[model samples]
Target: MSAANRSGADNQPGVLVTGASGFVGRYLLRRLQTEPVTVSTLQRPRHDLLQPASLTELCQGVDTVYHLAAYAHVNQAQIKTLYATNVDGTINLLSAAVAAGVRRLVYVSSILADPAFDQPRTAYGEAKQRAESLLQAAHQAGDIEVVIVRPVNVYGVGMKGNLMTLLRLLRKGVMPPLPRFTQPFSLIGVEDLCQALVLAAQCSVGDNAPIYALTDGEHYDIKSLEQAMRTALGRSQPAWATPKAVFYLGALTLEIAGRLLPINNSPGLRSYHALARNYAVDDTASQRDLGYNPRSTFYCTLPAIISAMDAGSAGADTSDTDNTQ
Candidate 1:
């Protein structure tokens, strides 16, 4: 059979993507267009997660709903906003999907929901966990086929996270000594994450599975990620690993200062906290069951991301200096 016939749902189920303007959403959209299913997107004007009426309409006749919209930032002021988007918005969308009789729902959650990181309080993770719980309840009620994808440290082109900040710093030749980085960190390329989302939407092997932790096959330490960034940028800078106590003290100072002053929230400190603890997940289940495979490594993919960012910045005749800060 042809690819179209093999994957097609015979027009009985269409696909709807939320957060269509996000980094992952962009890649997912590109991939979905190649599929035979009908595609619809929901985005807000400012936050752009689609209005309720539009969302309801899109949910109608949609077999799969990929819910990727969320307030992704982890800052003090963003806590409430995160709950509003990640929890409330998810409930709204899932409710609509239920009403529309959507066949499957793919929720993009974070590995922070693992409950391993107890201290420092991850608002994003809390909201995601709550949403997952809600979805689980719905699944129990037989409302729809729900698959929750918990991706870890997703980084690649168009990714805005701690790793991106490090890349920006590296490009500017500022290498900070990182400590408390012994934990094995997992990463998933944007493309691989998109593929997993697609597979989760289409897979019929399980019914309403609540959770899947998606990651690249291998894990890397903080030093390795930093070195990858350095290699990607073709910059050779000496970086010393500070003592964990000193690093935590500096991070605490910076965190306090950020709270008091207007500072762009740093993911570095949060990442330090994350990497200070073990976060390695076995994606073997996902690989064996859903055929989910990560395509690229941080070492291979970071350069392409940097190159694309550079090309875009150059094409627009915009200085990278302005965009980095």
Candidate 2:
């Protein structure tokens, strides 16, 4: 393992945040600035995961790295790009961190890394899973202290992808009847995730374990999810519960349309499969290992997310909001 202490303020930990300009990265950077730590961003001209040559310079003097850079695209067509960025890039960054004598790494992995979902795993999820395996191997070899976190349905200001799409449908009074499933969907706000990450970076490292954790706190089932969100958003339209056939038909139609048209707004098969998996993570270990108490629930954070959606939709073309996160 690299020689460095996590709890020293005199020689404070030099934290490096990859994907610093991204949605969650921006929140993390903001939170880091409030602490007595040295901060650096692995962004743009000087540093990039795609450009492996840039990694050494970014890793220099950095004691802890918050790796959030990954190709988050859900489209199967981007599989090659996803593997190149998510898997290979992590290998390159891990190598760089080891060479730089970094102590610990807090990797921003996804809950979808599991292959136990209702549908065949996505290329995006597969890529993230491969990346986690690589990081875990390095930890097992004593390269660094690894804290791998799998977050479920991360939502906050400036969020996009499936959650926002569902919210939009609800706002337009076209939200399909809530599904009858009783399985819960967990979520973590950007702010809450940032706090957990800080805790991960500060916690004492030992030969105890690799520190694998998930982020989740609420228990909003699909049926109650719609009701809670509608109430929170002050929607007057009462949502109905439809059969699985209705959703399947709608998803298939949209999938077919996406292939035919130039539209890229389709949610694809993975979105349908995701809602059926009882998608919530167990946060007990996270709460015990790191002082992670996620404060935002699905119902509470909707206002910020809606405002962000409005701001994003009003100013830019569709291409600007074309994120897969």
Candidate 3:
């Protein structure tokens, strides 16, 4: 075990945030700025995970690292790239952090990392699971204190990915009225996730690495969610519901098209399952250990998200949005 992993720094800890330009990362940075810690951010081209050489010095003089940089799409074609970045890149960062005598690393993992959710997980989920295992091994070896936070679907202002795509479609009125899906899912606001990350970093280090699953502690089904969003956006509720078969057919078409054509962000079986499946998580440990009490719900934060979408604060690019979150 490294002494650095056990002892406190004499001065305020230096914190480094990877993926500082990302949706959640941006929110985390803003939250960190309000704290007393010295904050450092990584620029992508200059400090990339795949380029292990670039990561060598990233953890130098940093007491804690917030690792949020991840390839967050579910395209199977990019499986190799996903593993390289999520799994191998994480190994690179672990090496750097250990060598730099960093004390702790707070990793932002996703709920999809749990293999129990799917019989055969998406490539992105597998990659995150692999990364989490590696981080756990490092922690076991006493290389660093590891705190892993597995957040369910995260939504907030400047949010992108599957949820954002849905919001865009809804705003355009091109999306048909969705069928009521009774399967409930969990979600965390970006700000709440940021708070959870900070709590993970600040909480006492234990003999074993701790993994915290986070959500806003609210129940949300697709029908109620759609109603809330529609009401908030001033969009009319559809007079009739679109049949489930219609959506299934659309997903099947997209799946076949994805297999035949070069497409990104296609709504295939993975996205379909993500929306339709029940993926609720228990965050009792987060509450007990880190005092994690989430304040924002999807209902409360819908306005900010709608406002961001309308004002173009969120990007229109389909390259990245975490549908598999």
Q: Please provide, for model 1 over 1-325, each residue's C-alpha lDDT reduced to its tens digit, 9 standing for 90 to 100.
A: 1211123355535787776666777778789878888777663442233345545665767778888777664457666776887788888888889999998899888777767743465676678789899999888788888998888777667776567767788788765756636678677887888898888887763444658878878888887787777776888746566788887787777777767664544543554576687667778878877888777887777667888878874122110000110
Residue pairs clashing in model 2 are 177-240
Q: Note the Cα lDDT for every prediction shown.
A: 0.70, 0.71, 0.78
lDDT score for candidate 1 against the true structure? 0.70
On lDDT, the stronger of 1 and 3 is 3
Clashing pairs in 3: 161-321
TM-scores for every candidate against the unseen true structure: 0.86, 0.85, 0.91
> What is candidate 2's lDDT per residue for 24-105, written digit by digit as tens?
7777878988888878776565566777777887788888899887766434455577788888989999999999999999
Instruction: Rank candidates by TM-score, best first.
Output: 3, 1, 2
Q: lDDT tens string, model 3, 137-209?
A: 8898898999998888888877766677777788888878887677888888888888899999989866678
> How many clashing pairs per prediction, in order?
4, 1, 1
- Candidate 3 C-alpha RMSD relative to the actual structure: 4.5
